[model samples]
Target: MTELVRLTGVSKRYETTGPPALDEVSVEVGTGAAVAVMGPSGSGKSTLLNLVGGLDRPTSGTVEVAGEDLGRLSEKRLAVFRRTHVGIVFQFFHLLDDLTVRDNVLLPAQLAGVPPRTARARATELMDALGLGEKANAYPARLSGGQRQRVAIARALVNRPALLLADEPTGAVDARTGAQVTEILRELNRDGQTLLLVTHDRAMADRCAGRVVELSDGRVVASTPAGVSS
Candidate 1:
C-alpha cells in the first residue's frame, strides 16, 4: 500500500526546560490502513495527532502527509493543507449548535471551496452511509450522542480527506453508542478510508485498527498488531 502519513524523529516541547511531549518518535500509516495510538494521559498521544493533523507543528524532525512535509509548510499553507488533506474528529463533537446536521457536515467542504452542489452530494452520501440520512434536517440538540458523532465523522469526511484522525471517539458516549461508533469506524476503514485514532479504549483499538502503537512518557514503547498483547 502507498504511504499516507510519515513522522520521522518527531518531538514537541511546550516548556523549554521540561521533557518533550513527543520524544524522537517515528511512525507511518499507509493508504487504506488504520492504526491506533494508545497511551495514558500525558503520554503524547494527542500531541502526536495534533502534529499529524497540522494543528500543531513539531519542534524537531518531520511530519509528512500525502507527500507534503508539514514542518515545511507556511502557517497559511498549513491551514490550507489541513483543509484539503486531513480530517479530524475531536473527542467532543464540535458541530455548530445552530447548524443542521447537513450543514454541519458540509462545513468542511465549504471551507475547502468545494462546489456547493458537490458538497451537498458528498454530505448527503456520507450521512446516508452513516445512517444519519433522516437526521439531516435535525439540529445537533435533537440528536443523541452517537448521532452527533456520526455527524462529526461525516463532516470529517466531507472533503474526502486522505486521513481521518479521531481523538477518543467514544469517550463521551454510552456503551451501546460507543459500540455503534466503533462499528461505523470499522466500516469506514473497510471501505478504504485511512484512519488514525488516539484512544484509551482498548476494545476500540482492537476493533478498529490493524496495528497499535503504545507510548509512555512521551516515547513509543511498543508497536504491535491489534488484539496482540503489547
Candidate 2:
C-alpha cells in the first residue's frame, strides 16, 4: 500500500533543558489503513497527532502527510493543506455551539472554497449517512454527546480529506456513546478512509484500527496488527 503518513526520527521539545516530548520516533501509516496510537498520558500521543496534522512542527526530523512534507510548508500553506487534505476530530467535540449542525459541517467546505450548493449537498449527504439528518437544524448544545461527536465527524469529513486524524475520539462520552462512536469510525475505515487515531481505549483501537502503535516514555515500544496483544 502507498504510505499516507511518514514520520522519521521525529522529536519535539518545548524547552532545551527538559526531556523531549517525542524521542526519535518513526512511524508510517499506509493508505486506506486505520492506525491507532496508544499510550499513557504524557507518552507523546498528542504531540504525534499535532505533528501529522501540521498543528505543530517537530523540533527535529520530518513529518510528511499525503506526500506533503509538513515541516516545509509555510503557515499559510499549511492551513491550506489542512483544509484541503486533512481533517481532524477532537475529543471534546469542538462544535460551535452557536451554529446549527449543518453550518458547522459546512464551515470547512466554505473555507476551502467549495461552492455553497455543493457544500450543502455534501453536508446533507454526510449527515444522512451518519444518522444525523434530523439533528442538522439543531444547535450542538441540544444534542446528546454521541450526536455531537457524530456532528464533529461529519464536519471533519465534509472536505473529503486524504487523511483523518482523531484524537481520543471517545474520551469525553459515556460508555454507550463511545461504543456508537467506535462503530462509526469502524464503518468509515471499512469504506476506505485512512485514519490515524490517538486513544487510550483498547476496545476502540481493536474495533477501529487494522494496526496499532504503542508508545511509552516518548518512544515507540511496540507495533502490531490490531486484535493482537501488544
CA-lDDT, candidates in order: 0.94, 0.95
lDDT of 2 at 159: 98
Q: How many Å off is the CA of 228 in candidate 2? A: 1.2
TM-score of each: 0.98, 0.99
Residue 87 accuracy (lDDT) in model 1:
92
Model 2 Cα lDDT, one tens digit per residue, 34-70: 9999999999999999999989999999999988999
Kindly list the per-residue Cα lDDT of model 1 for residues 121-216, writing each as its tens digit. Answer: 999999999999999999999999999999999999999898999999998999999999999999999999999999899999999999999999
Best by TM-score: 2
Kindly report which residue stretches of model 2 are placed more than 4 angstroms away from their true locations once superposed: none
